[model samples]
Target: MASGAIAAGLPAHELAYRELKQRILYGEFKPGRPVTLQGIADELGVGLTPIRESVRRLIAERALEFHGNRRISLPQMTHARLEEIYTVRSKLEPELACRAAAHITKADIDHLEAIDGELDRAIAFGDVGAYLKHNFRFHRALYAPANSQVLLPIVESLWLQFGPSLRVVCGRYGTSGLSDQHKEIIKALRAANIGAVREAILRDIAQGCTFITDELFANENQP
Candidate 1:
């Protein structure tokens, strides 16, 4: 199945939605930065009709916010929402990782290693965009081996909504300040320890939540 409703050569509406969604997912759209339909149309080389439709869909998903002036922007993170997201992820992702551990092959581990290496390079260069992209790729790689027909779509929607805010979090805490849990995940996978893999994934999610929640609180307290 398509990763999302949008892809190249899809009908105009879907094409627009997917391209716009990908940009939002990659943090190309900064939180609270107003995005006009025409502006997105210009950026994506499409028309305003498709942009308008896609923006509406994104708003319904809570991925984009429609403001008083009719401006649309990425939603800023809140403690409650962040907590809720982490809570769901804590429950779901570890389960998926555990399943992945059972089914993972040597090639899967090697692919994960390669992705993590790229992630490290992104962090080293302070390439926040690349870091976020590769981090998504790493998780997707880890879970794909599980062949989850049921959980994949739900997990993907969650990732789509969470992606932009994650970029902001990465900015607040640079690569040096971040913990690398993919290493532990890889080790547990190699050992074929399902429990260990689950724990490792839980730790990974919690570690990221810490960074984001800390930053959110810090910003909340600012004058």
Candidate 2:
């Protein structure tokens, strides 16, 4: 009974963490934006204790940084850090996708297809926020069947770092081509072709690399 109660409480804690993390990652709380424990508690309608705990976890993850006394903000992205993250993701995500392809069901494909539709709608309406939301969901859905809870959180942390910069890229280059990758991924999954799925996932990540690489060079050449 005690274990059951503890298990039940986990989701609420995770809920607090995820909500706070998403806001930080998605640029709802921009870099250098101040985050107060009480403000988050009030915004989330939770107690100060849970909000404090969530903030501490994020700080540990390097998603939130503290400076001087009592000031916290989202971590700023740098070119070297972005390169390192994409390198790690380039190695892991494709393998996870291939593993997931082996176990994917029709329902999983259906859900992914629906998410693709949402991406399309977000693109059509020029809603960057919605596009990012659906894009994250679509990628998560692709790897859901892998049951890799261990690596998934690591992947999410990478996303936390990558997500805001992705917003910058989308704002500059537009996101119309992103949805097209989903079609290829889904086709590979439907055929249960692990190699093809892996290649498609790698291709997707590589495209982001190309964009970020160009952005990095552009920033260097500025001024």
- Among the numbered candidates, top TM-score falls to 1
Each candidate: what lDDT?
Answer: 0.82, 0.79
Candidate 1: what lDDT?
0.82
Total clashes in model 2, counting residue pairs 3 or more apart in sequence or in different chains: 0
* lDDT by residue (tens digit), candidate 2, 135-164: 889999989899997888888888887787
- As for candidate 1, its clashing pairs are none
Worst 10 residues of 2 by lDDT: 1-10
Error of 2 at 155 (Å): 0.5
